[model samples]
Target chain A: MRIGLIGTGNVATILGRKITAAGHEVVQVYGRSAIHAQQLAAELQAAYTTDMDHLDPHADLYIIAVADAAIASVAASLPLQDKLVVHTAGSVSKEVLKVASTRYGIFYPLQSLRKEMEQLPDIPLLIDANTPDDLALLRDLALSLSTQVGVASDEQRLKLHVAAVMVSNFTNHLYTLAERYCQAEGADFSLLHPLIVQVAERLQYMSPQDAQTGPAIRYDTPTIEKHMALLEQHGEMKELYAWFTKSIQKQAASGEL
Target chain B: MRIGLIGTGNVATILGRKITAAGHEVVQVYGRSAIHAQQLAAELQAAYTTDMDHLDPHADLYIIAVADAAIASVAASLPLQDKLVVHTAGSVSKEVLKVASTRYGIFYPLQSLRKEMEQLPDIPLLIDANTPDDLALLRDLALSLSTQVGVASDEQRLKLHVAAVMVSNFTNHLYTLAERYCQAEGADFSLLHPLIVQVAERLQYMSPQDAQTGPAIRYDTPTIEKHMALLEQHGEMKELYAWFTKSIQKQAASGEL
Candidate 1:
């Protein structure tokens, strides 16, 4: 399968490499930056282009792996007619690619990709298409790069995207706050690493509600009070702490946990 | 070391097994329930007693691994004098053991322990003692069970305890919310697992600030609004989503991440 990568960012670099490694030909790379496009194109042994018009029209798939905000403009500028064009975004709808091609689809890989990372994460791909043939093609392409693949609607994708944010992005922000709090208090932040990993590992065997522990889940008011007092100096952290504590207690009281 | 365990809960069961495996003598086990104490004592090949007064007074260390609320009462009831007494608590103060023994300390294993786990987690021990001798002894005991050990003050422990909640307990709650949302939307919750693990694995190489992704970090208001609209039915989750989204945006605006 010949592929045309429509960006030179982390997603494009990593996914382009993976697509090429899986015996698919990344025939063309397009980007706003000449150097980045050339670098990615050179690495993937593909032709480089900054203009959307120069994109290989005969490519089996055109993957618009650009930033979310740039997807619409890129899709609009592309001159492809009926060729399969897909965007790799979790939040954005597949209809965003409709302006570029008739046979548009989504090839959302639900993993955080980093250019610095040596190995690509186990990307559980979520494929969606306007038509059945395009859906099957996206699924086949996704299966080539990942063992896990599923079909989902635009609404389902958005819900999963929100869920992904809750589990990954918001959770990481909590970690950031914790690290900051640890550093401010002169405590070793690494002390919490094992506990962090344990919580994540527990999800494999148990529901998060069943796995919940600590002062908030148990409603140990005294400890919660102490924590609240400690975070009084940190406005954002204090609000976050209180919100989570109340939320946890409310959930526990609701007999959900 | 001759150790007397004062509880038969999850911490007691796992830590007792580790202590015995580390070549220390679990001299006695004490619990409110005779059956629980006897069961744990039998498993560890130690003596059992339901009465606090019948505790082994000559033991080198008395470990009160009970509920946080019961710590002060149990410590006060202990019949030890000069023997080292420690409570396995994150937020509780070492001063709680003041009535039990003069050589009071803390042996806080920072990982969440479960009886079902076949092997002990990489227990990062945070020790605090009134004296250097007791500190060394606690450190040695901790070292026997795990290589990770460090000294922390009561204030420091409280801060870390708060951080632990942020990273572990709060994170798990978010996972719970995500799972619930997935179930409601009829999406595969397993699709988010790899993304979840990827976010965790990124922490090994980068700080959470650098590891953060998704609409929240990007301050993508359109997607945020879409998510908010989708979560209208989930009262708690809706508030949580708004809070985290605002917090992430604020953090980003502050140039923290």
Candidate 2:
């Protein structure tokens, strides 16, 4: 399959490499910045473009893997010439590209991407097209790249995006907070590594409800108080510690845990 | 080593089984409740005592694996006769057992222990005693059960305990939130399983700082707002999402992440 890859960002670069490795042609690379586009094109032995006016519909597919907000703008500007176009976004709708082309869809790869790192996870590829014909083409393309590919509507994708943020993005922030408190107390944050691994690993074999363990889960008020007092020096920890303990206890009482 | 397992609670029963498995004798199982003491003793094939006054610490090592409050009272009731007595608690100070005998310490296992579970983790044990001899004794006993052992002071164990809450208990609560929201949306919570596993796997090769990803670290405000608004429907998630996100951004700004 001939592919026109847009946005020489982390996702584009990683996916482009994978596509090229999988014996598919990355015919061109497009970016807001010409230099970034050219670098990726040179690596993939493809053409480069900075202007949407220069877009060639000669390629079988145009993949817009830019930021969520920027995706619609880029898709809107592209001179699609009736080519099948798709954006690798979890949140954006397929309608964003309706004006730019006769055939449009979303081709989202569900995993965090890093430019320098080469972690090609066997992630789920969610594909959605404006029309049935476009969906078939996108499904074929998705299947070539991954076994865990499925066709989902915009609403389903949006729901998934919400779930992804809750589990991945939001969870990482919680981790960052814990790290801060640990550092402030002159504690070795590495001590938490096993626990992190344990939580993640156990969830595979057990439900979160069954795997739950803590002061609040066990209803150990004395231990909870000791933990709060331990965080007395750090103001933020003190507040968060109190709040989370209450939340857990509340959840426990409500049969949420 | 001969063992005197005190407080026939969840942790005590689990530890007693492990001790007996390692060919150590659990000569005495003490608890305030007779049924509890007898059940544990029957399980471990050890003797049971309901009366604290009738307690005889005949084993080489006395393991105080009970609740935080009972640690002191149980220790005060014990007639150690110069035997090594250690409590398996994170926040509890080793000084409590001084009332029982001069030869006492803390044998804190840094993992969640459920009585009904069969597969026990090779937990990292934190050993601390008043004297070098007691420390050696405690470390050796910990080593006999599992090789992952550390000799830490009260301060060190406390530090690890804080990290434990962050990674295990607190993180698990976040899992509960994710599961609840997913269920509310009539979505399968299993969708987040792969994401959870990926996050944990990444930590094995990269430190938490380097492994950090998502909207908060990228400072994607629009995505953050959308997530918060979605979480707004659930009071707990909204508050937690706000607190965790704001905390992450602040930490990133302060060069913590």
Candidate 3:
């Protein structure tokens, strides 16, 4: 399967490399920067194009792996019609690609990507298409890069994106705040490393609700009040601490967790 | 070392088992219930006593592994003096043990413990002592059970407890909420597993601030608003989603992350 990739960022670079490594041909790479396109295309042994019109008209799939905001304009400017085109944004609607081709879909990979990563972890692909044939094509392409693939509607994808934010971005922010708090107290933050890893590993064998621990889940008011008092100087974290504490308590009370 | 353990809960049971397995003699086990203490003592091949006056008077260290609320009462009731005593509560001050013995300290393990765990992971023991001799004794005992051990002040331990709450308890709650949201939307919650594991794995190689990715970190207002609108029906999660989003934006703006 020949593929044309439209972007030169982390997702585009990582996905393009993985697709090529999986024995698919990344036939053309397009980016706003000619040099970046050339560099990535050179690595993938694919042709390079800075202009949208110069994208290979013959590739089997055109993947617009650009920024979410640029997807619509990139789709509109593309020269393809009645051909498979997909955008990789998790939050973007599949209809954004409709202006580029009659057969459009989403080939969203639900994992964070970084250029410095030595190797990619398992990426779950969430695919959606306008037609059965296109859906099949996207599924096959996703399976080539990942064993985990599923069809998702725009609503499902948006919810998944929100979940991703909660687990990844928001979770990481908490870690960041924790590290800062440790530094403020002149405590060794590294002591928390094994604890953090253990918590994550615990999820493999148990539901998150069952995995929950600490003062909030137990509703130990004295401990919670003590922590609140300690956080009085930490304005950002204090409010967040209270809000999360209340949410956990509410979940416990509702028995939905 | 002849060790006397107090309490029969998860922490006491697990820690007692590990200490005995590490070649220390669990001289006696004491709990509120005679049967419970006997059961734990039998597992450790040690003596059992429920009466506070009957605690092993000659044990090298008396570890009070009871609930945080019971620590003070248990400490006051103990007949030991000028012998090393320690409590395993993270938030409690070491002074709680002063009534039991002048030689008192803390033996707080940083990881969440459960009775079902077959073997403990790397438990980072945070030790605090009233004297250098007692500190060395506590450190040696900690090292016997874990490779990771550090001395932490009461203030530092409280801060660490706060950090642990943010990273472990709060993070797990977020996962719980995400799974619930997935269920409500009829989306496959299992699809988020790989992403969750990937986010955790990334932290092993980089700092959390560097690891943050998603609309929250990027401050994608349109995506944030869309997510907020999707979460209108989920009152608890809606507020949490908004708070986390604002926190991420603030972190990014302050450049502290």
Candidate 4:
């Protein structure tokens, strides 16, 4: 498929390269920033465009890989009529692209992507479309790039997005707080790296509840008190630590484990 | 060096096997439960004893791997006089073992251990001692089992323990909540597995703050509100989402990132 790549952010850059590698020709790279558009276009050996009105209508599919707030505006500006158009935003609805083209869908890659990553990480693609043919086309395009592909409605995709935030964003935030705490205490944060890896690795074989361990689940009040006392200097981290500890204890008390 | 393994829980079982694999003799396994002690002893090819007074006196090092609350009591029951004794509890001080033996130290493996794990994960061992010679001896024993060894004071080890709970236990709990959310939505929880792995893998190369990406960091109010609405039925998760979102926004506002 000939693709018109929209935006030149992390998602666009990474997915543009992936689409090109998957044997789809990215005919044009579009960005508000001329430098980024030109750079990505040069990398893909494609045309570059900063004007939304000048998006290559010759391309079979147009992918809007911009921020959630910009997806609808970008779709509204696109000049395509019958060409299949899609936005890569997880929270945005597929109907946002209806104004852009009759044949519209979604090609949301459910992963934390960064263009600076040396190698492509495994991305699970969640797709949706207004029509069966468009859905199949997006599915085929997505399957070419990722083995884990699913057809999800706007609601389902949003739910998964919430879950993704918990697992990726919120979990990483916990790490950030821990790193800060370690730095303050003059302890090496890297020492906990193995434990982090092992905990995540265990999820492949066991459920997270089964994989859960530490003072929280054990309800070791002494250890918990000690930890709370140590975090007195970090107000936000202290509150978060208390919140998470209570949540764990609540789960345990409910006999869910 | 001959070792006396105390407690037959996950830590004791794993460390016992690793010690034997590293060519140290596990002369005896002691536990309050005879069945557990006998089972672990059989696996390590060591003698089993339910009575703490009957523990092997010839063992060079006695490792107390038990619950944090039980460590002090267990140490008090041990018969060792001048032999080097260490309690593997991270929060427990080296002084806890002073009653059990003249030579006391800490040999805390800073990793989440489970007996059912098919392979031994890389465990960063944190060692501490009351005397210089005993510290050297503990360090040698720790080095045999793990390449990452450090001499940490009691306070430092406790701080690391707090951080370990954040990265491993609290992170896993986030996964647990996400899994629950996915289940409620009738979405496949495993779909987020790659995302979880990628977020953690990136931590090896980048700090968590640098790697953070989501509606929270972006302060994307519309998306955050949508997520909060979706999580309306999940009171605990809804509260957590709001808390984390605010925390991330606060961090961003502070120009920490």
- Per TM-score, the best of the predicted structures is 4
Per-prediction TM-score: 0.96, 0.88, 0.95, 0.98
Can you write out model 4's per-residue Cα lDDT over B89-145, one digit (the tens) per residue? 888788988788898999999999988898988999999999999999888889999
Model 1, residue B138: what's the lDDT? 90
Residue pairs in steric clash, candidate 1?
none
**Rank by DockQ (best first):** 4, 1, 3, 2
Error of 1 at B170 (Å): 0.7
Alpha-carbon runs more than 4 Å astray in model 3: none
> Which ten-residue region of model 4 chain A has the weakest summed lDDT?
A248-257
Per-residue C-alpha lDDT of model 3 across residues B1-257, encoded as one tens digit per residue = 89999999888988998898899999999998988888998999999987888887899999999878889999999888798999998899999899998899999999888776766777899999999999999999999999889898998899899988888888888889888988888888777787777777777788888877788777678888898999888887888888788878888888773
lDDT (C-alpha, whole model) for all candidates: 0.86, 0.78, 0.87, 0.90
Single out the weakest 10-residue window by summed lDDT for candidate 4 chain B. Answer: B248-257
- In CAPRI terms, where does candidate 1 land? medium
Candidate 2's C-alpha runs over 4 A off are A17-25, A33-56, A116-118, A140-150, B7-10, B13-58, B115-119, B144-148
Instruction: Pick the winner on TM-score between candidates 1 and 2.
Output: 1
Better of 3 and 4 by TM-score: 4
Candidate 2 clashing pairs, residues 3+ apart or interchain: none
Model 1 RMSD vs true structure: 1.8
TM-score, candidate 1, is 0.96
